[model samples]
Target: MDLHGPLRDASDTILASRAIDGDLVAFEVIAHRHGPLMRVLAANLLGSELESDDVVQEAFISAWRHLGELNDPARIRSWLMRIVSNRALDRIRARRHHDDIDAADRASTGPSTEALVEHRMQLDAVWIALGRLPADQRRCWLLRETAGYSYAEIGETLDIPVSTVRGLLARARATLLLEMEAWR
Candidate 1:
């Protein structure tokens, strides 16, 4: 334990307690612990590492603003994850809204035939399969797989039921599996 470590309780309860008391260090500790996961969620959701930092920053800001309302400190990780996921979702939605018109005119860039890579080809195949899915199914699949969110957590984030989350993921998985079978 770094003697300077924020919050007396390395345990979340005391850490959250100290943070709620306006301890910047305590909150910083929380951010340090969870930042990578938040970034992964954002990066995967937005499909751009460039915007992930901003998304996570927004989540931390929201966390700072709302930490007091949290009922369980032990569950802080999940709470922070939810904020990050929601922030990422907001960014993705805004980006689509802004970029949709230009999208049709965009030309994709890829490695030339001479420079083709097997892993990149596989990734492209997966991306294409995912693109064919309905927007809701794709979003739910990404939320579950990328963020490691439980069905209930995904439901809460997307404002749907757990059963719906399961169905969406199921459909997404089946579609992708069928589409990627050629790669095997």
Candidate 2:
């Protein structure tokens, strides 16, 4: 068990309060505490750890700037993650905007042929099923599954209700189940 990362300590709240009061060290401690998780989440969304670093950095900067607006300091992890998620989504949109659809594959890393083929097929199927979801449902599923956010956290992050989140997840799962039936 990682003893760090929001272990019901008053320290997180204390640090946040101090940071809000203009203490830079407290802010830095907060950053150090939560930065790794934020980076991993961004990397999962953006498909690049390097870009994740930049996005999380931007998130921390934004968090720093808006420290005074934070309502609950104990929930800071979720708030920071919400910032990183938005940043990563923005990056994804920008990348898609700049994508060259006509471009050929530029390179390939060495992988055994059978493994690569199997992985590619599974990924293609999963992505296709995911693509069929409504945008809101898809985002909810990703937030819940990928970030491990509670329904309340996801609702807060996406500005939706917990009931809506539950409904969306149920619909998304039903759709995915039907889509993945052949594989099963």
Candidate 3:
């Protein structure tokens, strides 16, 4: 009679279990509970709220489809986050490989003289250097620096070990410092 009522108050474990049992209301509850945070994580990863919304929606659909495959129902939030991160990463990869000639030409247009202030130039250089970094390194750097995530948090979100996170961060820092030496 009131399928949604009990689901609203259920724990993630309970909801995940029910979702695995094909209860749409339970899955809906899970989506509603974690969607905002998932969107923020996607936005932080992808740098666009609109893209983040699509990534989050895609994640929910994926979760719904594979709820039965979840090994640990209690960790549903982290699982959902991992899905969102992977989806956002996929989008980034797609953007990198799409190769729109017009977009490339437009971006190649050099900045105006007045627009190349010292601060702007430095910022532009940083972005250019960041773009040069490998995708994993860039993701680690952005998660730690822009999102203010702890190394452990970044590792968890990216499904990598803490040691690997540290190593990637070190390499990213070294590369960025070298690339920005001129700005210093």
Candidate 4:
């Protein structure tokens, strides 16, 4: 049977099932079908085209390994999204660590130039402002504004109540507005 035949049948479940049964072609079909959306999502979350590509690749590998664990095959999109999110979060954590090390190295070396010192100070100010936010508020702001997730979707992704997501986002916006006003 043609690949699109099963893909068009009903849900991605059929394609997933075939892929799980060791059908490489079916798996490739599934990957190709969802790859673009996955890339878009990763790019939005990671904010770097290269990092998004790496995240998407990792997500696909993870999905392939755990395909059997997915109980509801029809929910493939959400499943894939979750994988992308987890992978992106991992990348974010790693990048933050790397940045911390770079910052420490720069501090130890002292300011080599006035311009570099000014840039470092600005980055420090921004970090301080962001750090002043409550963790939930910061997370909500990043996921909604940076990652482009809806409130309902953020609630799902974060395992929080939708009302809580709404409140946190409101608080985050208020805090940012205040900070921006102070800057000006």
Candidate with top lDDT is: 3
- lDDT: the better of candidates 1 and 3: 3
TM-score (C-alpha) between model 1 and the true structure: 0.59
Q: For residues 1-184, could you state the per-residue lDDT of candidate 1 as single tens digits?
A: 4546435448766777788889888888788777897797788778789999999999999999998898888778767877887788677656533433234334367444433445546766877787789977987887877667789868766667899989999999999999999999
**Per-residue accuracy of model 2 over 64-130 as CA lDDT, tens digit each:** 9998889988777767877888788778757644533223233255455666556557756877787
lDDT (0-100) at residue 126 of candidate 2? 70
Across 1-184, the per-residue lDDT of candidate 3 in tens digits comes to 3645867889999999988999888888888888998888989888899899999999998988888889989888878887887788778767744544444445657554444455556866877898899978987897888667898888887768999999999999999999999988
- Candidate 2 has its poorest 10 consecutive residues by lDDT at 98-107
Ranking by lDDT: 3, 2, 1, 4
Ranking 1 against 4 by TM-score, winner = 4
Single out the weakest 10-residue window by summed lDDT for candidate 3: 96-105
Best by TM-score: 3
Tell me, what's the RMSD of every candidate?
A: 8.6, 7.8, 6.2, 6.6
Candidate 2 whole-model C-alpha lDDT, 0 to 1 = 0.78
Model 2 stretches with alpha carbons more than 4 Å out: 1-10, 105-139, 144-168, 171-184
For all candidates in order, the CA lDDT equals: 0.77, 0.78, 0.83, 0.75
Q: Each candidate's TM vs. the true structure?
A: 0.59, 0.60, 0.64, 0.59
- Would you list the rank order by TM-score, best first? 3, 2, 4, 1
lDDT of 3 at 171: 99
The residue pairs that clash in candidate 3, if any, are none
